[model samples]
Target: MKRRHFIGAAVASAAALGAPMLRAQGRPRVVVVGGGAGGATVARYLAKDSAGALDVVLVEPNVVYSSCFFSNLTLADLRSPESLEHGYDRLGAFGITLVHDRATGVDRARREVTLGAGGVLAYDKLVLAPGIDFVPGSVTGWSEADDEIFPHAYRGGAQVALLRAQLGAMRPGGTFALVAPPNPYRCPPGPYERVSMVACLLSRINPTAKVLVLDPKPSFSKQALFEDGWARHYPGVVEWIGPDAGGAAVEVRPGVGEIVVAGAVLRVDVANIIPAQKAGAIADAAGLTEGGWVPVEPLALATKADPAVHVLGDAAAQGDMPKSGFSANSQAKVVANAIRAELTGSRAFPPRYANTCWSAIAPGDGVKVGATYSAGEGKIAAGAGFISQAGEAAELRAATYAESFAWYDAISEDIFG
Candidate 1:
């Protein structure tokens, strides 16, 4: 059968079996809040694998999602922001109801989700995957109002464009300062990749330019690999300061484009401030957060507050998994299978997860770190992992870069298609 026709038939069959039409027929409803990597993947797999036995609804505020995974490439002009934007048409074709609205509240007592659009969705199971929100007041003199002066660009979309434009408008021989977030934030390797991309761009436009990274943590993901690449690819252009060296004690003055580090003020051309982050606000509003992020059972991704409600992705404090798109996608599959087994008597398998984070240090130079995980005593535990070694062949580095591009395409398709 033709692909289009097959999808059409699938949608028709799914709608017929949906809860709205088949509630009297006893179809179980699964309402997913936050249609990102985790939420979208769970909704898709539940609806597709259930073969019209489940009613799945996805709630997301954005009509098009610009992935944070490859967004750093936008700064280096390696990829367009438009290329990272994906729509839900393919997901809709699989018979999931796509509601483009924000979730205002989740009522655990009633198992209902309140929508900003003035409707309540009741579900047999609720999944929350709202991603992360920056902690207020974490960065002095930096807020949403000052985003133009100090772009976070961590959430992708317009922020990415804003940072790219700021990089382009930077004066020659000026310094680009980056304030890295604390540990346990989304995408551990993200800030370093941004530094590399900014360094790459600055080298072409302004060889005499400098990039300063003020990090709260002493070490970062793939530290040796990134440091080696920085020296080899953009020698003397990038400088990193750890907390012991006064990177932690810092304040920013957006009004004057200056950053004060260790009691020394330095004027900067562009400042990218990534403050500490926690689970999204909705998760807090639902009373799911005890210490800023929701704690979940590793195997089922079920919230400790309520088992009927599952939390995945960055919001859930699942051990050993970095808050990356790949980790979220992996966790979503486990949750989907568990939910299916509960509703449809399907066999539930043991949960296993994996994640790989790829970083582009320079053009044609890429590196990665990844691990396989299993549910352990009280948390998810890392099993085996690998990282790119130092002093690799140039061709091998190029191949790694190529592999990253391929992974991007494949993962995006896996989530949205």
Candidate 2:
């Protein structure tokens, strides 16, 4: 639900999960952290291409990972966690070492990675791709433990289960609150889409149940599409609280199951709080994130803080781009390619990025966004991007949504099928 809980639960354990102690031979060691979209992608690509030349060690707590990208569709009963859960069984074929441990620290000077349980793992080049983390004291009266009472579902899987259970237990006409964090958090359009899907779920069982969006910002991605879809589909079932409407959640109390916003006190049956974030702590422990997120030489996707370390995914501070799974996965390619070139002493290729975010508006209809990126002086810049048009044609919308499924499958295939 909350990003850190997923990290702690999914990636915090090592030896308990039965990771191999053996290191592949005759290859440069490559260590990867957090095996969601980015870390898994990097590990698969590197191990596949490099094989014996590069030993890819993936540090992740979960043997199977469920992606947040399509988890909202699960609310519509269009998909399941099974649709997103993936394992790196093929990594062995590519000579990748799978470690079920969270990276606790990095030895930049020694070029080694320290895991929570597995101790020190030597790496010729380390790849850190752990996903987002909630900012400490993000909302007043709400610390990490409040997570037990409110499930964010920003990080997918078990959090989805918790939120679903809460939804199931609530009264038919109960309120579901979607508390959106400030800008630059993971999955820019995630909060709105989540509310829409939750509305879809509630509308089926309880037409009177309402989905309330308490947004920090004045604007959101695909607002027109979401508004029209809500109006035409859910009608009075969904309401959005924007800045003008004073809809920001300034504080939350799990003990009371309430959120204090602008000037209103709205009690909710189910609360999803997407908090502000930073790069994973391993980056901070290693002094990689200077201005909060890791600042990188956009061209190489290499952390200027430590050249031996490359930070990709939600952790890397790429300005303007939303901290998203797609962004991280796209950035993984650039970093992986750069790492390949660096290890092989080949001509470095100019980096390019591809990102696509898909949000399920209904069971069969979805809105999508895409973009291309190139490295600039200090930060990565968007070269080209597109968003799905409002009030989509049914055939095209269905096709586009289907393409989202294809994209997930293809991306995972490229990463770790």
Candidate 3:
């Protein structure tokens, strides 16, 4: 039942079971591992588009999915955590099989997936959308084991709730320290957006409090937009340190609630340590990873190691796309089309992908960065990018914020339904 027992168990299982499991009812079966934005969208699409021609099975350990996309809003009291939770009951109407179990391993040779619940699923096509997992020791003196004292709140659900509770209990005039991760992590602008939201929360209740951002990178997504917003709204409240100022040199002591930046120790009331990340363990279990991510062909998102297995979302190392939910949902459509074309002989069209990441800096104030993508030069290449500019009109910013709300509703429906 161990999730990491991949190669040895898969090889033994393949040897014992000489023939691949027959497709259910003689229809091509697509097994999607992970039920986040990418998996749910692709699953719903395949079932809806194929019209019962293909059997779609989605394997996810959780019955309810809490999105990390807007969890920051919860911290600022703009949204409640319960509002972010979505159940899978709606997907049942599509005739997709929902397996509430963790995918332990993938047997590429036999085309079977091992589940933690002691079951196996055979698939003609396998999709990995497991998202990101933290890299061990990426942040010195901080680890997942110490997350209780210093919550990362990177993933949705309990962790976010914990961080929110800690923030709520923070003393007046306290310091909130955030350790941002490196490039190629999920939601490039997420940590910064969280900082903005936190500042908004504290500005009302704890005006004397401080927000510290320790970033390993020199600059981040939507840097100008965020910096300008911070200065205008939360002046003298947020301080950001980049790599040149030893932002990269960080160490935390959860026991004492202390963090060392550039060999200087500071005690903080709350610390959100977002460490480096990699492809989820399931991708590694399938032996499809390279350089902490799954290398995928641009057109269909198929893994370089095996064409039958496609990687999506944060787990995929496809070029030019920031690891965001919008990007994943966009990639899912392309993957769905390519998968359906191959499995059910459906008409395939040229793949076109798009993504827009929106960040709410303050109440009714939002900024965004996005791009369109297409397959080129063995990778997903960016084209026609757009971003929110500094010094925008308040009405436009409010409209942009309203647009993000609509997008959240639309995309959630598109994913869970």
Using lDDT as the measure, which candidate wins? 3
Error of model 3, residue 374, in angstroms:
0.5
> What C-alpha lDDT, on a 0 to 100 scale, does residue 275 get in candidate 2?
79
> Whole-model Cα lDDT per candidate?
0.89, 0.77, 0.90
lDDT per residue as tens, model 1, 1-417: 111111233234335544243333468888899989999999999998998889788889898999999899989999989999999889987778777778888878877788776666667899999999999988888887898889899898999899999889888899999999998899999999999999999999888999999999989999999999999989999999999988997889999999999889899999999999999999999999977899998889899889999999999998889999999999999999999999999999999999999999998999999999999987889999999999999999999999999999998988998
Candidate 3: worst 10 consecutive residues by lDDT?
1-10
Native-vs-model 2 lDDT? 0.77
> Higher-lDDT candidate among 1 and 3?
3
Number of clashing residue pairs in every model?
Answer: 0, 2, 0
lDDT of 3 at 44: 91
Q: lDDT (0-100) at residue 30 of candidate 2?
A: 75
Write model 3 residue lDDT over 13-115, tens digit each, in one string: 4335332223635788898999999999999999999998888878888989999989999999998899899999888688777777889988898888998
Worst 10 residues of 2 by lDDT: 1-10
Residue clash pairs of candidate 3: none
N/CA/C clash count, model 2: 2
Model 2 stretches with alpha carbons more than 4 Å out = 1-26
